[model samples]
Target: MTDNALAYRRSHAFRTAVTDIGGHQRFTRAYRPQTNGKAERFNRTLAEEWAYAQPFTNSHERTAALPGFLHNYNHHRAHSALNGQPPITRLNNFAGH
Candidate 1:
């Protein structure tokens, strides 16, 4: 039951059930992170929320924390873009409609 996530990439956002409109990328000078703003933001979020959120003694501990982090990120953390609601809320609303 997958949608635009078909075994292909950038097929067409919204062409099917969904569209993953990722930002474009190009060679940029050093210190110009805005060149890949969307990916950069997600990377920073992952770093700040999961990778560096707490101290882990080993790789296993960090691996154990990933599921919890992903759950919180998808179900609890609010996104300003969604009017301060978690992303799952939008999906649920859309599906209900």
Candidate 2:
């Protein structure tokens, strides 16, 4: 889900990618801050822990680091909302775990 950003609404590539992934695109409603809280929190966390965690020489370098960051976030980092467990801890029958 995203806020009502014009780019998301207008970008064909974005829409196509979402569809290709079998995902549905949703927009947060205006004046409903609670509806966007999780997404906003995730954005903030992503920026703080990955996007700006270190200096990168180029966009490619930053882009290449995303998977590793995501893996660590999902498998290692503790979350208060998860009762201080990593996100993976909540998964039942997670393959190869």
Which candidate should be chosen as best, given lDDT against the real structure? Answer: 2
Assess the local accuracy of residue 19 in candidate 2 as a C-alpha lDDT between 0 and 100: 96
lDDT of 1 by residue, 1-97 (tens): 1222234244453334333323342333446556456556777888998888899999899889988887788788889988988777877455521
| Model 2 agreement with the true structure over 1-97: per-residue lDDT tens digits | 8888899889999999989967799999888998789779989999998999999999999999988998888898889999988888888876635
After superposition, candidate 1 runs with Cα above 4 Å error: 1-35, 92-97
C-alpha TM-scores of all predictions: 0.57, 0.72
TM-score: which candidate is best?
Answer: 2
TM-score of 2: 0.72
What is residue 74's positional error in candidate 2, in angstroms? 1.3
Model-by-model lDDT, in order? 0.64, 0.88
TM-score of 1: 0.57
